[model samples]
Target: MARSRWLPDQHGAWAMLTVPFLAGTFLAPHPGPAHAVLLAAWSAGYVALFHGQQWLRLRLRRASRRPAAARCHVRPGLVFAAVFLVLGIPLAVRHPWLLLAAAACGPFVAVNTLYARVNRERALPNGLAAVVPACGMLPVAGRLGGAGLPWAPAAACLLYFWGTVPYVKTMIRERRSAGYRRASAAYHAVAIVAATLLSPWLALPFAGYLARAVALPGRGVKVPVVGAVEIAGSAALLLTLLLVF
Candidate 1:
C-alpha cells in the first residue's frame, strides 16, 4: 500500500514520459544542460501530478471515501511539486518562451482534471489527454537543445503515443470489448500510413505495431509481453527517427 499509493501503477507511462523527451533531446544537433534540466523538471512534474490526481480522485469520492488513502498521497505530491518548481523556475526564467509550451497543455490538463474529479481517469479519453503533454515534451525538449532537426521525430512521437491509447485499451480496460480491438487495429493501420508520410523509415515500426495490434488480442498474452512489445515499439520508433533525420 505504501509504495503503491506513492508511485503511479501505469507502467506504460514511464516510456510515454521518458522516450519522447530523450528522442527530442538527442535528435537535436546540440544537446545541452537546459535539456537535462527540463528532463528533471518534466519527470518531477509527472510524479507530482500523478500523486496529486490520485489524492483528488480518492478524495472526491463520498460513499467509499477513505481519509487514510487520501492522506498518503499528499506528502509525495507536494514534495514532487516543490521539486518541480525548483528545477523548472530558473529554466523558465532563462527562456520565457518555455511558458508558452507549458501553457499549450492547459486544455488537456483541464480534461484530465475533469476526469479525475469524476473518477474516470482510466477512460480512453483521459488516457489520450495525458499523452498530449508527454508527447508535446518531445518537440519542447528538442527546442531546448537549441538546434533545428526535421520535425519527423516530433510527428512520429505524436502518432505513436496517440495510437497507444486505443491499443492499450484493447489490452486492459477494454480488453474484452471487440469494438476496442477493432478500433485499436484500425488506428494502427492509419498510423502506418501517417508514419509513411512522415518518413518511409517510420512505416517499418508502425508496421510492426500494426502486426501486434492485429495478432495479439484475446490470445491471453501476458502483461509483461505486452509491455515488452511497447518498449520494443518505442525503441523502434526512436531508432527509425534517428535514421530518418
Candidate 2:
C-alpha cells in the first residue's frame, strides 16, 4: 500500500473499488452508516485478497526455488485477512445479505486459486475470474446503500472491463502481433458502435477508448502515458455515469 504513482498492475483493483462502489453509492437515495461500513469491509477484503494472492505466489516460487521476499508477505497477508474477517463478522450480522456476496466470492476465489497454481494469471480465464468479483461488488454496493440491485451499472462495468482485457492484451502481452492488434481494435470498434446504438451517453467514454485503442497501440507510446490516458477515460466514464444515471 505504498500508493506511489498508480501501478499499472493494479488497474483491476482500482476499478473494483471505484466504479461499482461509487456508482452504487451515488445511485442510492439515502446512504448511511451501514453502507459506509460495508464499503470499508469490502475494500479491506480486497486488500486482503491482493496480499494473500501475492503471498501464495511467493510461496509457490519458493517451492520451485528459493527467492527473496518469499517470507515477507505471509504475515502481512494474514493480518489483512484477519482484519477482513473481523470486519465481515459484524457487517454480516448487521446485513444478512452480505452472506450472499461472500458465497459468490467463493467460486471466484476458487477460480483465481486454480489459475494461480498454473501461473496463468494473464490468461483469459483469469481475467474473467477477476471481473466476476467486481460484478458481485455492484450488488453489494446497491444493497448496502439502500438501493435495489443495480444491474444496469453492473452490466456497464462488466462490459467496459470485458472489452478492456483484450484491448490491454494487444498493447502489452501480445504487442508484437499485428493480427492481435487488429482484433483488439475491431473489438473496441464494435463495442463503441454497440454502445452508441444502445445509448449515446453511455458510449461517450467508449468512443474515447476506441480512439486510443486504434490510434495509440501500435505507435510507441510510453506506459505511463497510456496509464494517464486510461485514467482520463475512467474519469470520463465516472462523470458520464454520474451525470446520466
Candidate 3:
C-alpha cells in the first residue's frame, strides 16, 4: 500500500513528539496565565502550519504527475486562520509570550515539515527534535522566575537524547509492525523506572528511547565500549537530575 504523505508519517511523528515537551513545560511550577496562553497558541499554530505544508506538498506532488495543474484544498488555510483567531484572542489580552509562541509555530512547523519531506530515507534528526523542547523550556523556566536554560531542562534534554538513540534504532527495524501494544508496554515500563530514579515526568526520555528501540532493532549492533558508555552516561544523567531537582 502506498503511504498517504499528507495524512501520517514523519509529520505525524514530529507532532506527537511535541506532547511530552509540552507536558513538561506545563507541569513546571506555576507558569502563570501568560505562559499557559503562550503554550496553547504555540501548539495550535504548529498544528496549522504543519497541516498547511502537508496539503501543499500533496498538491504539488499530484500536479507533477498530471498534464494539468491540480487544484488544492482551500479549507486548510481557512481552518487554521479560524483556529488561530480563537486561540490567540485570550493570549492577546494578557500574555505576549502566547503570541510569540504562536508566531514561532509557523517557523518550527515549516522547518520540520520541510526536513521530513526532504529526508524521507533518513531517520528524524535528534538534534532538531531537541530544539523544540529546549525552546519550550525557556519560556516556562522564565515564567517560574528562573533562568530559562537551567540545569533541569538541560538534563531533561540530555536524558531525551540518550533514550532516543536506542528508540530510533527500534523504530527503523519495526516500521511496519502493528505491535504498538507491546511497544507501549515496554515504553511504560522503562518510563516508570526512569521516572522513579529521575523525576516523575522526566520519563519522557525513557519513553522516547523506547520508541526508537521499537523502530530500530539493535540486537546485533555492537559497540566496542558500550557498557562503559552506558554506565558513564547513566551516572551523569542521575547526578545532573539530582543536582537540578
Identify the candidate with maximal TM-score: 1
lDDT scores for all predictions? 0.85, 0.72, 0.47
TM-score (all chains, Cα) for each model: 0.95, 0.88, 0.50
Superior by lDDT: candidate 2 or candidate 3:
2
Q: Per-residue alpha-carbon lDDT of model 1 for 1-245, expressed as tens digits?
A: 46776678788898999888888888887898888889998888888988887788888794275678777888999988999999999999998988998899889988998898899888888988898888888788778887554467777888999888888778766779999999889998999898898778887888998998888888888889889989998888877776777
Tell me model 1's lDDT, rounded to 2 decimals. 0.85
**What is the lDDT for 139 in model 1?**
80
Alpha carbon RMSD to native, model 1: 1.6
Q: What tens digits encode model 3's per-residue C-alpha lDDT throughout 61-90?
A: 665675232233335445655676787787
lDDT of 2 by residue, 1-245 (tens): 44431122576457656776777777777777777777777776777676666657767766567564555555556776787788889988877878877897899888887776666778877887788787668667777777888776777676677777776777777777788789778878887776665567888788778888888777777767766776777677767766776
Angstrom error of the Cα, residue 1, model 2: value is 10
**C-alpha root-mean-square deviation, each candidate:** 1.6, 2.7, 10.1
